[model samples]
Target: MHGSRSGRHRSDPGVAAAAGDSGLKPKGPSTLQALTDLVRLVGRSNAPQLRLRLVGAVLLTLAGKALGVLAPLVLGAAVNSLASGQGTAAAVGWGFGGFAVGWALVRLLSSTAPQLADVVFAPVRSAAQRRAATETFAHALSLSLDFHQTKRSGSLSRTMERGARSVDFLLRILAFNLVPTGVELVLAAGVLGARYDWRFGAVAVVVVAVYTASTFALSNWRLEHRRTMNTADTEAAGVSVDALLNYETVKSFGAEARSAAVYDRALGDYTRAALKANSSLALLNMIQAGIMNLGLGVMAVMAGFEAAAGRMGPGDVMAAVLIMISLYAPLNILGFAYREVRQSFIDMEEMLKVTRQTPQVADAPGAVALAKDTARRGGSIAFEDVGFRHDARANGLEGVSFNAAPGTTTALVGPSGAGKSTIVKLALRLLDPQGGRVLIDGHDVRDVTQASLRTAVALVPQDVALFNDTIRANIGFARPDADEAAIWAAAEAAELTAFIRDLPEGLDTRVGERGLKLSGGERQRVGIARALLADPCILILDEATSALDSRTEAAIQKTLRKVRAGRTTLVVAHRLSTIADADQILVLKAGRIVERGAHHELVAHVGGEYAALWRKQTRGARART
Candidate 1:
């Protein structure tokens, strides 16, 4: 079946192939018509395989309904035969025998249909779920880094999971629940009209119509409640993730109680919303049960009268009553199925919104590929009148421009909130400069492919994040195709091979979530090893050894000299001694460069901020000793 225009398909047939021969536009339908349109809309795909499965299901359902109607008629015939006294024993015996067989057949089919439906629908449901998840994740990853910075990872993950599950729910409703219910309704109406009179059919139709209307109305009203519950649940999840990630900090401050209180507030809101939703659902169920049985009572009374007046035979009356009760089985699921479908629609809308979001940092059309270049032969990095500001921030960097020649280490030291990281982020194209440009090897960063640009640069972040996997796997992530020898060499250069070799599993040991099993110094070494494996032309150490012990820091400092020998390196650090041997140091304050000189030269300047920072660090180091 084809989806609606709102859910556009890849292929469109000619206008002549549409429902209208004149090819005129089709107007929107009324609510009842719209419901029919929804079924047609869902059926528009017209997949031959799906059609065949649905056809088979419909045939099975009709057979089941026919048997169901037959059982009651047979039982009523036995009663009539006993009343007539024409070989009553023999007549009753045959009638009951036939009824037993027919009843058994109906019961057997009723149980088998769901199993058959699942077998047929599983592939379609899985395919739709896969499509939805793949698209949602791809779209999220494609968005600019700035967009990601503002969103929570846990929340995004939850949205993607919910969206994917929604597709499965929708497919099951459409393929199994809703479709079978529709078929049952049609069959019941036809049998009632033929066996008894149009009045019986009218009563059946009215009850179903009222049941459907009430279901829709109640579901629509509950939508806001569900949405509120979702919001509260998301907030609760986000709070827990945030707290757990910062557990150490919370513990350090002895604020566990405060954190728990915050979480409780979110959970409390969630509980209230959940209660409201469930309560509303219960009320709907209660009302539906009352109305449906009342309608059944009315139909049963009419059927008795018809039999007494001889307008319909006793068997016909019994068949009409039996069909009505049998049809209620599917109708019972109809209410909950409708609710799920509406919920699925809401989820689909959210997923589509995310999927349709255009990436802000998309590559220009006809963009050229970036060519690989090693540090041994790579050239200088430069920025020209670059300016940037976060969408949420009023100011970031303004007209900042600088250059670091190849075979030199440029250290950027700054006060807190000085936009030093912003410069790095912009140069790496993680955040595009609103004005001017950043160039690497004389090529504009935006002019070349991101893959090529990233391949040319490597970053070792201050807070090194490692995967929960083998030590070798984490280190070799930068170069997945690297051999064991290459991995060992990189680890040795980072001064970590000896420690890894001593572990129980050597390099194959599991890291435990975010490398929590490893010490701070060890995690830092792993980060360095990853960067060494990458061997990018431009290397960035953003306080790479900050978490290490002083002894380990001193050791890694020696490793850094060898690593930066031929590479263009940018070091952002607060510890002045770490960058004392750098080719140049840029001191920044309030988003602008305050001073630029060698460390020794900057130290010699009496009134410079770098000189004061140096004295303060020297005093602190002496106190620690």
Candidate 2:
């Protein structure tokens, strides 16, 4: 039967070929597309009040710029009044007073506008950041188990953090800095053209054009270095987190030096990339300074020539120089802003990669909720010719069919790779069968909502993972609203009451990361207690007693038998002794059920697979004795 199963249930070449595609590679959209998407994401917060605030911010920006531009003109007029021989002392005093007041007021408005804009837009920026993070996180959780398995947790977490921060930075730069700077540039050019010579305006335009072109060219060249640095940084962080998470493994193998070497190598790569990026940055800054100073020199020399030629006054030169100086502030920021903006786009694109992955499993539109009351007795489960394949090389179930009647215990005994755990996951709807249907209480499992279905079933796996929290909290996780009394009752059923009472903090004791603070048997017992607390209609024990000692196993077996009286139980066991008395025993080999019957009936069949397995175990028991 096993040989026939393999031949008849070969996986399709197409499905097997695509099984390893995890969608982690950085295949980001075009720059234009990314910018458009980011803009839309920021503006998605459709608050009418936010729109009003945005308008107010824009108005303040324009008013501040106008005031700033008018200040230099007033200063120039005061300088002209001082130079004029026909002007009286009173006129000079009035000119000086007006200049001082204008300068102070312009500085006040220029500084005040951005601060007020920040206040008005604070809520909008925060909302956008929160929305982006929440949606990305929720989408990540909804993805299939396969994707999570292939991804590094630390790297994934970093992507989310960096991505959200990038969005906030981009919004602030575009709204308050980039747009306002452009407006200021235009106003400065207009003033030079209308109030001064057209040559002055042309010089201003040339300076800006040259500065912008040089910054962009250099920034684009530095982009590859930044990307390399980010990659190395992410890799180093992932390695450190992975090593720390498996600290015990490192200690046991005496591989601390090896881990350190790996980490150092990653850091070395990062160091090289960072040095290159910093060097490029210095080069960009030097070139930018040269351009700005050169422009100022040319403008000043021209102003002096015009004054000597009687075409302009000394005050006009002061005004031209002042306007250029004011323009310097925004221009300086423009270089930094452009570089950071490009890097921000890269960060956002990495996050978008995660969000773009289509979930392998999702609830169908208009899916109905599971009827909890229908399984009052027990939920009857059936696999109708179910099939699945992890990959072409890995063994998976094929043409496997079975039925567990309500209020009965069924045991599946199989070798290590016989698809026992796969069957369990399929029953839970964690992985949908590619070729067949799984049913609970005569209804298709996929037809109902996953949340409702999962609530009705509880599983106790071989390896129990616990949060870094208190024992009471972990147990109560199965049913968050469960009363303390109910929690104690479940603990008692799992034979964990005495253990808890002996602890210093009792139920309040903290379980270290993944419950490493507890022994193997203790963790398994806690898992059993949590499952029992749920009071699920169907209980699945996937090698649940594998870690227990002989004595603890016996005790747990007794508890299991007592619990099996009302609820339907499905046991996947490697220890044949644990399931000897199960109502029905299915012997699986490769991916097929080669033998099926009561334990005694299968063991009595001459030369059968079950009999051979029973003899092997019996001989081993005698040898141990």
Candidate 3:
């Protein structure tokens, strides 16, 4: 029943409270203030989500306290009547029966209210958590490509997963454990003072004070140990995920024993940390038991003295004893609850780090939409003395200037790590240049919207990535609304239509993760088909045909020639044969362009870098044949 409602609140809150204004301060005076701040955050736009559950939970708590106070009084009355030697069985029986009913109400109200809270707040918590995850993921997508290049996928995934799950634990502690314990504390103190003498009330006060202090101290000790445990668990999870992802590499190198040794170290750390946490909790429980028993013993002796002096009746003793027992039950849980609340804060902090981040790229106020030019002069790319570097590195590209006129092919030829890819990335606006500007059709890329920029360019990567879906879906990814005929036309142009048609399910066959079901050449062709379907103004091929055989590479090159009539095409290739007929080729070395000219002219300069690369590539082709 609770799960049913949780599924209903999955819609995104369209109007987000401005990001990072949650006003969470670590320097709070009391737990109450911290809880209030957290509640205010979760309830910023949707006031009803917190208000309804909070009111219901408080009312239920009052109901439980009221029943608890009454049950003890009834038990006291029955004991007094019997002690006074009243010759009335009906009266005593009625007293006992009333106590039973009151006890039942206490149990029902306390237990049922928390369960109801879970049902009510479950949906709201889930929605908030979903919003947080989506916002983080979208922010990551908008971040500069250099940020992604330095981070590990497995670690990032674990961080987000744990951060989202933290909300559920926090809600449960707030709704059920924290609220009820507070109510129980107030009711116990009130009952002791009202019905018994101040001495007895003082006993209740001192014992409760000591119990709370002890719980706090022991819980803090255990919390430190639990933090260690959590670290070990995260490390273990990271190692396992990394090993599983690189299983093929490990197997090829016969590193099974080495992998096992690493996994065992992670597991050993986790086990040691867990054992320390459990042992500390067990010690804390023993202290709690000792304090509770001693308090009860003192109360028992005091009641006996009062009875002997004829100042207090047997009923008073019964009432005092029952009240103490009732209070002790919740007190027992307080230690563990405090520990959990502390752990929850650690989890919450991880989530806040992601939510509080400001994305490097955000749309400016009143930003202009990018418009494509279809006049006689259209689809041109220009780089004006651009300089770039990753945040952690000193150099990526420096003082580079270039232009690709409309309706022409500009090829960049360079060895690996020579900044050829960086130039292509700059043209696609994947990363903004640190020192200069990239212009598309005479408009700065930063001045336009991200959606418009993405729509204006299509990139074919060296390693084409495909989702585990139908072949048709993978090819039509650029334009999901493309009709069957348009998809078939693009596939035909890329020379992939015949192979797709030969499959039993034709285009419906599942490609599997990263297109594992297809060969390297087939995946490259699918990527080309996707790019062709988009038909963007600027096309980028970054070693797009490097994975194919000579024949397949020649076929794709011929197809590209026909499609390059009126579009700006930028090619980054290692094979000189692929770009031998390009209108112009730029040779790059160590983040600088050392040579730029027609291919034949570059080859004629025997000392030029492009000429050396062409000689090496041609020699490799001869050896392969």
Candidate 4:
């Protein structure tokens, strides 16, 4: 059943207090806020091993940068010594060989350090991604039906996947690329100033600053394009999933062409958006490369002048250029990192928006488990002047009140939009009434834990949905610990024993998505089996046997009587013949019960709603025969 909202103000007394502003759309987090949140999350992780790996990664990154900066100087010294040519053959060989070996060792370690760091940090990054996805998924499941009804499952899943991937990307690129690059830049500048000339240091700082600033500005400008692309991607994914899930409907109407056209249009939008984003990224990369090469040119010119004037050797000039080249390597990836980091922040923000949404229906503080009436064989249900109004419906349950005593059956029959389903939802506390309370076993449902209420009620919806798993798994899902005998007994009672016995795999036969592999009647029987396995005090059969043929329906009807013997059964029926023998029948119109009596008594009324419906159904059946 759909969710309902209060037709009155917040100050209104009664069950209107249970309604909340679930429709309030929340804003996504900003980049700075996302960064802060990630920092806090890492701190809160509090894993000693994670902290140790993090620390090792940082220390190793620094060591790699330092060694990289020093390697050029060592190589330059070796070049200068060999060039001097002022010693014996063996002396020169020893001097140059020692310097060459030292340089090779430093350079070898420099390249190896970052790899080791990545290896050590792998666990931490994976753990973060797992925690993010798991927690967000769990939270999404906890959200009320109102939020879920309005949400696109595929889009939500895409958001979660992108968010988790973005976290991994940010950790890898920021830690290994951006942050380490900054440290490398500072160390390179310091080495330049302290070794050859301060002019080299000054030029390095200016060029790096310009490159960083320009990359940041351009990446920010490209953010809108990326956002558009992401939106289109999500929309495309959602369309494909919806089309596939409703494959039967599409096939029924021969609408495959329409679905394909819709998907093509979505892809077209995504392609255009992606083109813009990628083109801008290409431009950013070109600009970054230009700045680095120009900086290198300036350093080379300064070094050439210094060497010409005898203030620096050929080796020193070579060392200076090599140092600048080493610095540019990390900056080379800087453009890519900036673009990805910006995109990642957007993804993270979207995930945060979903995680932050408040559930419209939440458990009350200090709520306890439902205390069933032990003396009775079945639990009783009562609605006291209950009222509800859906936003899209003009008529909903209004000042409606009814009761089904223990061990009795109450049937609700009504025209479309007459609130039969709404009544069922209210009984199960899926949606709290706006004006009154619902009691189960003489205890207010709202006052008890939702889990406990769920334990006492079982529902078999009109369209039964099952997971893509074995038949045994779907039935056992209702009660995981239910043993084999109990499951077989329930299936046998539901008239599924013959069907399963004939199947090649029996209970192990796998049902396709939403149990579409089975026929309507078969799925309905599966639903009945699952509900019977639950063995709740309150059994809700909403058109439970609507899909079966007459013979099968008759058989199930007899089985249902046995199942409902000691249970308070609530039947929402459309076929008048189905509920003709119900203990008490309520005929509803426009959300109000217009007649209440046994089926015989209601049919005896001349020109009444129940009498009219029964005559029409009976005539339709006769005509079919």
Best by lDDT: 4
TM-score of each: 0.84, 0.92, 0.87, 0.92
- The residue ranges of model 1 lying beyond 4 angstroms of the native Cα positions read 1-100, 221-231, 261-277, 600-612, 615-625
lDDT for each of the candidates? Answer: 0.74, 0.81, 0.74, 0.83
Ranking by TM-score: 4, 2, 3, 1
Model 2 lDDT on a 0 to 1 scale: 0.81
Candidate 4 displacement at residue 101 in angstroms: 2.0
> Tens-digit lDDT track for model 2 on 1-625?
0101111111000000000113233444577987887877768855448778878877877777666677777777667766764678887888777877777777787778778878887777887778778778988998987788778787788778777877888888888878887788788889988888888888998998999999888877876665676566666667789999999999999999999999989888867876676777778878888999999999999889988998777788888888888887777766667767766676777777788998777788887887774536878889899999886436778888888998888999878888888888898888899988999888888898888888888999999999999999999999999999999999998989999999999999999999999999999999999999998888999999999999989998999899887678899998888999998988888887888889999988979988888889989999999
Better of 1 and 3 by TM-score: 3
RMSD of each: 8.8, 9.1, 6.4, 8.5
**Candidates in descending lDDT order:** 4, 2, 3, 1
Candidate 4 residue lDDT tens string, 1-625: 0002112211111110100112222244676888896775556554449878999999898899999999999999998888887779889889999999999999999999999999988888887877778878988988887788888786687678777777787888888878888889899999999988999999999998998899788877876665676566656667788999999999999999999999989888867876676677678777877988999999999999999999888889889999989998877666556666665776677776778998766688998998664654889999899899998888888888888899999999989889999998888877888998899988888888888888889999999999999999999889999999999998998999999999999999999999999999999999999999998889999999999999999999999999998899999999988888888999999989889999999999978999999999999989999
Colliding pairs, model 4: none
TM-score, structure 4 vs. true: 0.92
Q: Which ten residues in a row have the lowest lDDT in candidate 1?
A: 9-18
In model 4, how many backbone clashes occur?
0
